[model samples]
Target: MNGIRKALRDGLVPPPPSAEPVKHRDAGVWTIPNLFTLLRFLLIIPAVISIFYIDERPWLPLTLVAVFSLTDWVDGFLARLLDQYSAIGAKFDPLADRLGLGLVVIALAWEGLLPWWAIVIIATVDLFLLFFILLMDAHQAMRVNWIGKFRTALTMVGVVAVLAGPAFAQPVLSTIGVLCVEVGAFLHIITGVQYARLAWLGRRRFR
Candidate 1:
């Protein structure tokens, strides 16, 4: 349990009081994980802008989304392989992810590719978590649940599909992409419920 907590702290939970601070990060100033995160963040601006720039370039947006999704995996892998995880990297990586997905959701809704209600729901849940994180100190940082991780993966895949557009000429491929999103949304709802419950249980403590 303590090791898990330490891992969380080292990776994004924020540095707990008990954990030592990291130093000596200015050598190359870039690790594989940081590079992945920077790439992911860099892709977001163009991806969102592309929604309005090209009418028939859905695939471009989808490609960017796919690449951004891979960043999540690559960063984690590099962090483990290189043992270069840092608290700043931990926070920045997840923030990049949320920013990427949040932009995708907004872009899709703006283009009328996805329902506004779904975007609203997602935004609300995200805000809920954001609020908790802002209110909590380092000690109370909420750990990412497995269900939440799965939900995030599904959500990114769904975003990629939406960006790919429905006119891909391959009906089955498109259908599967849409299905992945729907399943992702389902998992999202479950994870949201669980998170809400956890927050409610600790409302007094947080206050």
Candidate 2:
């Protein structure tokens, strides 16, 4: 018994506690992070407007898009940092992402900045993923996978690249951005399939 006690005292065993900090997912809805999320939606109006006036002020949409992305990061950062995670926020954030990103992509297509097929692919994937999420909500498999994260990053970069590239007359960037978007869209399909499989597995497991 003394020898076992000595081993524990000497830190010979790994700690049983989780290494990650605890986040309060059930925190209040009236928190700063939620406010930031609201602010993100407000910014979207101007982002879309800027797209319409891109020829008049080529930099506006680019800057707003950058800020829009910043808000997305900030809200999540604040959510974790302040531990203010509410059910409304948990639901609202992704809704905002899908809505905001969809609007931006659509607006880009409206302005001839993106192709209609890109819009179709993205919109289709989002709709399918939303359905899958609803189907599998009971399994608690709501966390994002690495592929989804990478796809989002690639898509955002593509958006910014496409905007900035044309504004600055840098065809190289425009090409790269379009490539990123295409690749991201392909990965989006992959993720949709992944989500469907997860939903099916969850249902089977429950059965």
Candidate 3:
């Protein structure tokens, strides 16, 4: 007993416990790390204006959408490169992504360019996932899976292509675009299911 006591005493440091250090990331408002996000927000205004003001150039705002999607990749890369990681950035980044995609999807559907069911499916998936996230709160920090990430990229690419030309004219591209949307839809559903399962298990464990 004396030997065990001495070993623990030597091994453990008797320091007072405290909360983890709060890292206040620089606002980065003027930094390159945040430029992409700013660009994304800026794009929304033009996209809305172009959508309503000009029907002749439907594809023009899609270029903005493409730019917004591309910026998602750019911002993340720049953040990592600059080592400007922050909790605020982490929280709002995904929100920005959802805003961009959701607005486009709804707009396209409203204009009768996109099928209503497709929009419904994606929105339903998002809603279900968000519900579980709210329930799990901190217990389930919703991290994007590789499949989820890939599907999102594919969906963005598909949306851009769909806007670029007639579906029949670009046979291969259209097929791939449809495939990408379908794959994205599947991933959204699967991810939501996974989140719900995790939330349920976590609640059970906590109880």
Give the alpha carbon lDDT tens digit for every residue of 1-207 in model 3.
665454444223322223322344554455675767777877876775655532577567667777888888777666655556654455456656666676776676676556677777878877665565556533233455555566678778876765554423454664565566666766767766765675677557657
Q: Candidate 3 has what TM-score?
A: 0.68
For candidate 1, write residues 151-203 as lDDT tens digits.
88778877776666543655465556656766776676777777666555555
Backbone clashes counted, model 1: 0
Point out the higher-scoring one by TM-score: 2 or 3.
2
**Can you write out model 2's per-residue Cα lDDT over 65-154, one digit (the tens) per residue?**
878777776777666555567766766666667677778888888988788888899888888766766665432434456686678778
Query: lDDT (CA) for every model shown?
Result: 0.66, 0.74, 0.62
Lowest lDDT sum, 10 consecutive residues, model 2, at: 12-21
Off by over 4 Å in 2: 1-25, 131-141, 196-207
Candidate with top lDDT is 2
Whichever of 1 and 2 has more TM-score, that candidate is 2
Error of 1 at 120 (Å): 1.3
Give residue 48's error in model 1 in angstroms. 1.0
